[model samples]
Target: MRDPILEGALRRVRDEKARDRGRRGRLRAATSAALAAAVLAGGLHLGRHSLPAHRILVATTGSTRMTTTITPADGWVRLHAAVDGIDPGERCTLVVTDSHGRRYVAGGWVAARREHTDLDGAALVDPADLATISVVTVDGRTLVTTTA
Candidate 1:
């Protein structure tokens, strides 16, 4: 009861539809992957900007070197310094100077018998007005100074 020509035509149409469905499925998977990658990239960008930026300064004088990282927040600044090449057991001071010649002592500690000493200090000064950061000896000898 079926015409051979009509049956052949219907078979071709069904085969074409199956191929089209496979293509569509592949395209959908690709689009989903692209969208997920974009969302992840955007999230990383936002997270990076949400954190405070840290400014690092390093200086060396003679055999002494000082590296300082400054973070400003809420009208105050925090400083983390690593000092090297100073003699062990020497008392040292971390000094933060403003552009107006005002000095704020961040913190102080005795040098340990190690390769480097790490010090943490905070100052009640605006970060924009920071001028110089110095590591000085207890008797007023400057070990190193870095300009901010």
Candidate 2:
């Protein structure tokens, strides 16, 4: 035979255990949600601040036109050039000049006779030091030049 007092005490213990488990589960869910929110906030902050700087320059000489987008990085600058009016099969060079008169060749390509010839290049000079950008032929003829 079970004593009524002992049975009542046992019931109370079981009820308390159930309530504690519920509390723990809720706590776990809340912690997970908080962690997710923190991760999302961190990602947004990085995305907003880590965006690269951009500048666009346009230059034309006689017939050829060039538009360049410059992006500054740690110790270098990235260049995206869009050129038009160059003859097919013409070899062209992209050059960057710094304030100290140092020249850097960013890239080169052969024109394809399309409406636009787009290419990318980089120079080991800081964007702040960049003075001029030029598109030139292999024989030192400048197609176009623009201040940076």
Candidate 3:
């Protein structure tokens, strides 16, 4: 014969254990869903940047070399350039020209003791309307030019 009080206590403990198991199962499902979502998002992010884009060789010199990789996104062309042989504390400007002969300029100063500089500048001109992009010195000497 079973003791009535002990039987009730054991039944209560079993019910509590069942509830804890259910909670643990739900937590695992939630964690798995979150991890899958994160992986998918990461893949999409990499896919956007991994696609082939236009790489235009802008300039090649013994002392300095530059190249522009133009990636089309939305309605505009994104410009990225790697520049070298720039003197420290020198002022440099980026110029972009449209087919209509309008020029856009982005200017910045180089760092001290830095011999190489990487420039990133964008133009509002559409990829179709872009004529040329160039990096020029303050005295108007062209350093790098990419024609579209």
Candidate 4:
């Protein structure tokens, strides 16, 4: 049990890596400074207007919540469920309607979501229903939508 030579070499390699990481901080700081200088020199021109991306909270069965980063809110809100717990003949629907009388229908999405829960799929709400992100129940059924 004598490997002093190999152990020394491994220690040297690890020490070098740590030292290099410490030195990299200076390089990163310089890079950020250069970027700031360029933006100041170029005046950072931007368009007259930009589209505002919608922000919505997604809640699904089995979890309190998760969120998607600021992205193109150009589709429907989706819900997901577990396959093992779903009944073969039972059906569910997702209906999203905006405050302006626009409606988005996502009937029979529960089956697909149950099938793909392992893949973390979402049943998207219609883009038109982007105006509401809350829940409204009717006739013993709960509806999901966007809200203020």
Candidate 5:
């Protein structure tokens, strides 16, 4: 019942639509690949140079293990520590003591207990002034201590 000319035109239009969908699919795949590559490159770059190279490991009396790392960046002494085996909701303070016995409280936080926790802060004194770095509980218990 359809005219020949109209049917031919409809077929051509459907073909064009199919071609557009294929083109779009290819473009979408390319865009996704490009985004994934960019993310991987950024992550590698950050992982390579973001932290310091020197680290000291210390074990706490509470059965927690910690590693202290010192990073000197932008004329600042950055003290960082990684701790594991902390109880969920437990509060702890990161303490930095200078050779002259001056104490600086970098920061404190409550553990989320996700198997490990990281704590970091900038020391007000020079890197050479650091004597001992320790993580202590609110009850004056030394969780971990490392001499600089």
Candidate 6:
């Protein structure tokens, strides 16, 4: 009986240690996954211009917001964005998505404060006709606006 009692105490201690070790392993894995997700998001934001061309809008209003606007069926579409607060060497990307979720990268560049870019693309779809439009910055800021 004394030997059996000693064996039980040692087994309980070993089980507790094993549980602690597994818990720590899971915590480390979760932290790593979260970090990987953040890195991927930042990388995607930087490469937003690699997609095909589509039209979008950048409101010249205060605290400039990007919105969708209609343009002539065959002409230039101007995009205005306020880079006053954007740091030097920073770039921005504007993207548009169709009803099928295919992405079109309309524009990407660096510019001075209160600048407008005249996007001269071939016969293009009007922005007001897009399913969704998104504007993203190099710092990973994004805004998605849907059309009627």
Q: Model-by-model lDDT, in order?
A: 0.91, 0.93, 0.75, 0.44, 0.80, 0.54
Q: Candidates sorted by lDDT, descending order?
A: 2, 1, 5, 3, 6, 4
**TM-score of model number 5:** 0.56
Report the lDDT tens digits of candidate 6 across residue range 22-120: 999999999999999999998998676343354444343344444454343333233333233334454666665655666666677664554333332
The segments of candidate 3 whose C-alpha lies over 4 angstroms from its true place after superposition are 1-52, 111-114
**TM-score order of candidates, best first?**
2, 1, 5, 3, 6, 4
Better of 5 and 6 by TM-score: 5
TM-score of every model? 0.64, 0.65, 0.55, 0.31, 0.56, 0.37
lDDT of 3 by residue, 27-132 (tens): 9999999999999999999887553567576676556666777776555667777777766766678787899999877445453544667777777777777788
Give the winner by lDDT.
2
Candidate 6: regions farther than 4 A off: 1-62, 72-88, 114-129, 138-140, 143-148
Query: Model 4, range 94-120, lDDT digits (tens) per residue?
Result: 444555766554334333332332212
As a TM-score, model 1 comes out at 0.64
Model 5: per-residue Cα lDDT at residue 110: 95
Say which prediction, candidate 1 or candidate 3, comes out ahead on lDDT: 1
What's the number of clashes in each of the models? 0, 0, 0, 16, 0, 0
Which of candidates 3 and 5 reaches a greater TM-score? 5
Which tens-of-lDDT digit does each residue in 1-148 have in candidate 1? Answer: 9899999999999999999999999999999999999999999988865536889999999989899999986577899999888888989899999999999999999988647888999998887788999988889999899999
* Comparison by TM-score, 3 against 6, better one: 3
lDDT per residue (tens digit) for residues 1-148 in model 2: 9899999999999999999999999999999999999999999998865736799999999889999999988778999999998999889899999999999999999998946999899999987799999999888999999999
TM-score of 4: 0.31
All candidates: CA RMSD (Å):
6.7, 4.2, 6.7, 16.1, 10.7, 16.8
- Deviation in Å, model 1, residue 65 alpha carbon: 0.6
Pull out the clashing pairs in model 3: none
Once fitted onto the true fold, the runs of candidate 5 whose alpha carbons sit more than 4 angstroms away are 1-62, 73-76
